[model samples]
Target: MRIGELAQRCGTTTRALRYYESLGLLTARRSANGQREYDESDLRLVAQIRSLTDIGFALEDTRPFVECLRTGHASGDACPASVAVYRRKLAELEEFIGRLTAARDRVRAQLDDAERRSRPCKR
Candidate 1:
């Protein structure tokens, strides 16, 4: 298939495919006429990239999985590299949630203080 077919099948855009190529995450070959062409494997690769990026993973972060798929694995996450990315994403999400939790606590305290201050003074 061509870039357009691949993009439509993968639920992504041609511009995104080109960007993935630029990032070296995706690849294509040139047809006899010099137009970019792809195959079924390329379709799977783009799907893996889409799945990862849909859940907040950076485009770069998806490279390992794409490489894994290229290596004949059944699934992109079948390799150690993809596992490592999952670990890293978990750590990042944990830290982000921790920061948000702390901010929530502080906001709650401020709201409590304001509410107490607004109450009428009863001797």
Candidate 2:
């Protein structure tokens, strides 16, 4: 397939595809005409990349999965490297959520305190 077909099938932009190529996440071979050419397997790789990035995974975090796919794994997460990335990401998200919850509680307490202070005293 060509770059355009791959992008359209993978629901990404040609620019993004080019960017992936630049990042070494995706690769292509030059045709006799010098146009970029990709295989059907590239589509699966793009889908994996999109899935990870959509859920807040960093581009670098996607490297393991892409490598797994390139090595003919049935799924990107099939490799130990990919699984390790998943674990790290999960831990990071849990820590982030904990901090967010604490911040929310602090903000709520401040709002309640302000409301109490603003109340008018009755005789």
Candidate 3:
């Protein structure tokens, strides 16, 4: 298919596809007319990229997954490089979760203390 068709099928814009190409994460073949062309494998690559980015992975981080697919892996995460990216992303998320949890606990404690101090004075 053409660039437009590939973008439409991938639920993205042609501009984004071009950006991916510029980043070396995606490549398109040139037709005899010099228009960009894509295949079903390109569709899978875009899907993998979209899925990862939707779940908080950076665009650059999706490179390994794309490369894995390009290398003929049945699943992008089948490669060690992709797995390493997954591990790093997971660790980053865990650290963020821990910090958020601590902030939440601190806020809860402050609210409780304020409520307790605002009560009416006893005789």
- What TM-score goes with each of the models? 0.95, 0.98, 0.96
- Candidate 1 RMSD to the real structure: 1.0
lDDT (10s digit) by residue, model 3, range 41-117: 99999999999999999899999999999999999999999999999999999999999999999999999999999
Off by over 4 Å in 3: none
lDDT of 3: 0.97
- Quick one: how many clashes does candidate 2 have? 0
**Candidate 2 deviant stretches above 4 angstroms:** none
Expressed as tens digits, the lDDT of each residue in 27-103 for candidate 1 is: 78999999899999998898898888899999889999998999999999999999999999999999999999999
CA lDDT of each candidate? 0.93, 0.96, 0.97
- Candidate 1 — what's its lDDT? 0.93
Q: Which stretches of candidate 1 lie over 4 Å from their true place?
A: none
Task: Give the per-residue lDDT digits (tens) of candidate 2, residues 1-123.
Answer: 999999999988999999999999999999999999999899999999999999999998999999999999999999999999999999999999999999999999999999999999989
What's the lDDT for residue 36 in model 1?
A: 93
Most accurate candidate by TM-score = 2
